[model samples]
Target: MSESVIGQVATTATSQARADVIDGFLGTTRRYTTSSAEGLKQAWDECDLIISHLALGATTRLIAGLLVNKKTDPGVVVVDEAGRFVVPLVGGHVGGANELARKVAEGLGATAVLTTATDALGLPGLDTLGWDTSGDLAGVTRAVIDQRPVALVREHPWPLPALPSNVTEPGVERVERRGTHVKVLPPPADPQARILLSDSTAVPDDLPTVVLHPKSLVIGMGCNRGTSVAALRELLDATLGVHGLAKSSIGVLTSVDAKADEEGLIELAAELGVDFVTYPAAELAEYQVPNPSAHAEDAVGTSSVSEASVLAHGAGLIVEKTKTPEATIAIGRTEPRGRLAIVGLGPGAADLLTPRARKVLSESAVVIGYRPYVAQIRSILRPGTEIVSTGMGTEDMRTALAIEKAREGRNVAIVCG
Candidate 1:
């Protein structure tokens, strides 16, 4: 669900005005104001964040026993009657309460009381390091804040942000393994206060470890004609289970060009919420794979459909070809690619353009547009922005170039008038 912000107000002129101001700042579609405590509780259950224009004591008493863990609870920010201070009452980092308090304080011209140590010390919390993570966040964060030694182990050299000085990889410096540590293994046999970055579904039973699922796996498939979707899905699920791989990590489903029209393969990819890609048979034949079948070579002009198709993208093979009666599947891991945002710069006017459109333009590595449209937002473009332009008559060429740039793993923006 999309994150929603709500303003909880009491029956007072000042509270109502403050709520209205907050609603205006956050946008009306997903922001609301409620007068009753019952309404606030309902909003709390439905929304991801709540800004209460009430006394901190009253707000605490209202949500007293219902407060849950930092990971699951909604972010709660309490604003005083005078709007002098914005205090995050619960779910500071993981639930984004601390960040929300800062934003709310900025909008209100008030002070934000942030009690989290990492935020004060300019260090990032371990839980907030990756896309999807869950584990003993509180323990590890506390350990890091207290300047204790922690271990970092990674299965793959996935690109990550620079960790704090206290967190180090094993064998870097001889430090006692006495405090909370972080590990990026699949599933450690003995668990401690550790953080794990893995796409494996198998979790440790005893240790308090955070598991982060990076979108690293790609599945390549080749199926016989007229195969049923149910059979293919079952085989794919079993294969992932046997390898301790998470379905969430599958970035794309790939195959040879011969199976592009296969409905079963397409449906499987759609159900898994990943893109389906096809390579030419000749292209797939260029890669050397462990298993080469003579029958597959005669049938599709590629000796190894699944492995070769995955390796054709320069990905590392993690799983060999496993087959069913009508299907064959392989898995590979690859680094994530950049996304493309096709935006329209409206009316060639800065005032007419939306803030989101401007932000996309600034974030884009390559901006493609007609010459006149590119000139409109030229001042706002960031440094190193590659501008690709065409004349007014060549809209098709602009679109094709934008698509090619995106396919090459660049964040592109196609601006239209």
Candidate 2:
């Protein structure tokens, strides 16, 4: 390993040892003293990172030492003497140990090994390791925490050999393998790890890690004071689908003024198998689009319908409109993507103006509405906001443009005359 190719081996070896290892591995690297422990300790403290040769005795012991003993937080890793295995000894997730392991394995011509369920089970990575005393992690119907063979229902990466039935459970559809160590998703080409399972539902309770399916989130919403649930749901759906998401991802529902108690929204959520959540009109009001219409006596607040979306994003829940034949079921925020806010700028000019609507327009990235409507905020367009001006046209064209902009994950303003 020439110093240049190996990038000058860094370590804390009385300066002499550091030079020795650099020269040894570089020029004529040699170990005159039989001090593996001393060298390793120095390597541990000297260089910022230490590389382990694959499941070899030294690497295994190093992993055990780091995890069981919690020595210095070195980036311990195992690679074959031939540069195979390349397993991250510690800090596999945030620290990039998992990624390093792959590189080492690749350097040694070994297969990359991953143990996460999403990778092992062959699903897109969306696992989590969290405590939900409220039991509201992510619409979890059935989740086994940090499972070994991950008693899971969904299938992820196909194992080298087919997974054992015991590896996963029947009812355990959602599986999350939790721990201090984070799991990495291998590229599609190389997924060759085994799935492990345990008879006990409880893992040893290490630092927790969780894995889960990438289901779209759903939120059932309820409103009041002449609010129509159907229009709300439609708005949410149209808005959500525009963003290339689905209805099934909803983990929970949200409504205005603690509308969680509202019967129509509640029933609708139950029908969809999602939880109903009602937030304060004030809270949901944060998402409300500014209503220029407020200046008018008839104008209410900014299109709070649009403001509701802020709740979904802030709540970590996607907003879905509940089913309702009466009220406008304008649900569309509950996409795998973020929520959609649709502002119905009230009838005309400065007469109906509200601070809330102004705030939304100010924050919107893509304002979708008639030329005049978007033109109303001549001075407000931020440099980043992409205003999509629908030409003077019919409701169909205007509606279409608003939906398109919202789906594109842009804050949309529907200036209906």
What lDDT would candidate 2 get against the real structure?
0.42
TM-score quality measure for candidate 2 = 0.27
Poorest 10 consecutive residues by lDDT, candidate 2: 127-136
Q: What is the TM-score of each candidate against the true structure?
A: 0.57, 0.27
Model 1, runs deviating above 4 Å: 1-13, 23-25, 29-34, 65-70, 134-136, 171-196, 200-211, 220-237, 246-314, 323-328, 336-417
Q: Which tens-of-lDDT digit does each residue in 1-417 have in candidate 1?
A: 134554454557787787777767766523334544775687678777777777899888888776877678888888899998999998787778887888778778899998888766655555554356656666766765665655565554443433555555554332221112323333222323455667787656454555667778889889899998898899999999998898877778999999999999999988977788999999998898998888788888999889998898667898999998798999999964556677887677875788688657755667777777888887777543657766767788777877776765557888876
Candidate 2 lDDT tens digits, 1-417: 112111122232443444343344334422223244555555555443455432457555644543433323555555444333445555444334454555545434467676544434432222221111111222221132232233332232211112222233333232221211224332222112222221112222232323232333434333454454455556556655655444544455555544445666665566656656555544554563332123211222323432364354453322333333333233333232322456666665543655567656655544556667767764555443445555554557657656764554445555444
The clash tally of candidate 2 reads 86
Error of 1 at 119 (Å): 2.7
lDDT (Cα atoms) of all candidates against the true structure: 0.73, 0.42
